[model samples]
Target: MSAWLPIAPCTPRDCAAHEGARRAPLAAAALLLAGCALTLLGVACVPGVRLLAPSLRDRLVRGWAYAVVRAFGVRLRVTGCQVEPGRPATGELVVANHVSWLDIPLVAAVLPARMVAKSEIRHWPVFGRFAALGGTLFIERDRLRALPGAVHALAGALAAGSRVAVFPQGSTWCGRDGGGSFRPAAFQAAVDAGAAVRPLRIAYRTPERAPAGAAAFVGDDPLAASLWRVVTAAGLTAEIRVLPPIPAGGEPDRRALALAAQSAVASDSANRPAASVHH
Candidate 1:
């Protein structure tokens, strides 16, 4: 079994606070538009608009999102991306490590995936509205009664060939050092839907500073301030690695598969070749 380790910690809270203060205007602008974006997306969900493939629309939305991130001064660097020969049909489940709240837009920039986000996100002004418009599947962490329905909805999406991205870690972490653990329940959707699991890893490295934990931005640490500090601080880049796809069936067990994927990401050398081992 391979052990996984995080590449870095969360950025310093002090730094995040400092930068966020400077980028207030930009953050406000983004937040304001966040609602308009969702409204536009909701309109696109109409029957006539639904005719337009959600994947297609998702791609456009993703592009816009990437542009937004860049505009906000964040640079994304992707590595160890294994391009499978034959692409799996839509509805495949993508499992990734949960790092920070920013993971959503970062992942969206790469793949056409709908996130399985927390229900609270549904209430977040523009973000919530757009997420719904983009067909995001919201799952309640509590209220056991809602689990079944949410699972059904996810399964239905997979059944129809839509790729859903799940953060198997369940919750965010301070970084790898902060006992980054994977929650097995997040894997249930892939198992139930018989979809392939694509394990993903994201590492955020501050150019001149260090990394922080998931809570790096709350409390007195204003959201806008933390984001700006990380964004404008020289050449900070986030590295996202997508390991090879694992078919959700047979032998190696889900735990073993999870470890395999975890190992691929935890490995330090980004330039190292990805191993293609089948059990």
Candidate 2:
């Protein structure tokens, strides 16, 4: 386990004062459209680019994510030990707490790993197409029969030296209660592939550096409403803390691996100052 270092805490007063301030909707819309265009263009070019340079497609996907983060005006700050991009020699699994839809771009902006998302996301208008082009692995959460196959596919990807990112909590949380308990099934992929599990903590803050509840997408929150809130917020920042990787060899089974990873994340979350607000 790594020591938890306290970053400067954002004040509630600062957050309250900035609540009334809003960015222009027209500007946000324009930026959103521009981002979508760039992403779609990148996706369209991937097939051709992949033929010439295999890695360039992944790089383009990452660039698209970076553009989305910037267009939304969200500041990203990463903490803790940094891990290099691409697959590691022993394989790697990134497990993180989920708070909002912003987590996707925020993670992609830094880490170059194929994300494991819910199957329904593949049908979500334009975003679905972008996700598929980015090489996301979709898991059918509602069908229990589909889980074993999904796990097997994930394991195969890892064994082939691909870094895979998963939100073991299965659903988004309000950044409260440590973002819910992590489900153990995903850990099996790590075990089967002999991969190390990396636990990451994601926190959102306002421009004033205060915890940002407005950025969280929880409950039955409409996607448009959440997007409007983030774009209109005075300022939003995503703070990502990457903890030490838990080696798979020592874990006796998937259950043990899952518990260890969850414990590490929970402990890190509890010790760190509550710097992000949730919806």
Candidate 3:
């Protein structure tokens, strides 16, 4: 006989929860469509204020990101010292571990910075347009020849006083192993620009104060499935710890800078409480 005997039947509560999960994705999809439409409309009007009043555009994008996160029923909690708006006294490079698709909006909601996203995202329907309008820098990670150009562009952006956000891990993990190790290639921009690398830790928890495993986008999980999980997850909270910035100037090279930032992020993630669900 197989060790796995016959499966147990679902209880009424379990069935009801499953039904809710089925509906959550539909609801989230509707909200996303509406949000994208509004965002596009706002972007269309950017030309009027692009030069005279630039910050207005950034604020609009940030507001859209906040609305999208709230619509998904995910609560965001930010801790640690925050960098003031506008260019820092020194160049700034924001580094964080990749978690779920939600990481993009979560970071945008907190900070106004151009993201360095994978090139595949550039063709992802409405989101691609939105990201492009928001000044995202797309890179083909698989192409070795493209690294120098991307790095140079990133360095230029940082030197121009733009806060650039990058996920050095190159891929998303299930928030296990503290998001694996950070890749040092992206850190080259910081070294070239002499920017300060600020590490941010992203953590997720359920309403019951447990790890929100359902919210993790790992393995072969589809985008729709992850969205359903997030929407149906009760009181899912995303905790963002904005750890102190490490000066790139002190590092001997890009690899050293990358290691230092990775250490800072891992240490912070280790010290924080496992579950950070706010009441």
Q: What is the C-alpha lDDT of each candidate?
A: 0.58, 0.72, 0.71
* Candidate 2 vs. true structure, TM-score: 0.82
Higher-ranked by TM-score: 2 or 3: 2
Candidate 1 lDDT tens digits, 25-108:
556466436634543554455335445655566556566556545554556766655544222565687776665656776777
Which prediction has the highest lDDT against the true structure?
2
- Alpha-carbon RMSD to native, per candidate: 6.7, 7.3, 8.2
Winner on lDDT between 2 and 3 is 2
Best by TM-score: 2
Summed backbone clashes in each candidate are 9, 2, 0
* Residue 90 lDDT (model 1): 52
* Model 1 segments more than 4 A misplaced: 1-51, 82-87, 176-179, 208-222, 250-257, 268-279
Predicted candidate 2 versus true structure: per-residue lDDT over 1-279, tens digit per residue: 001111212222222223635778787677567755665676677556556543565666566777777777676777766556544775689998877888887777666788998788899877688678667899887777787888898999888888889888776665635656678888998898888899888878766666677667765667776777777775677877777889878689988988888888778453464443221
Lowest summed lDDT across 10 adjacent residues in model 1 is found at 1-10
Per-residue accuracy of model 3 over 35-58 as CA lDDT, tens digit each: 556556655654553554446656
Candidate 3 worst ten-residue window by lDDT = 1-10
Give every collision pair in model 2: 211-277, 212-277
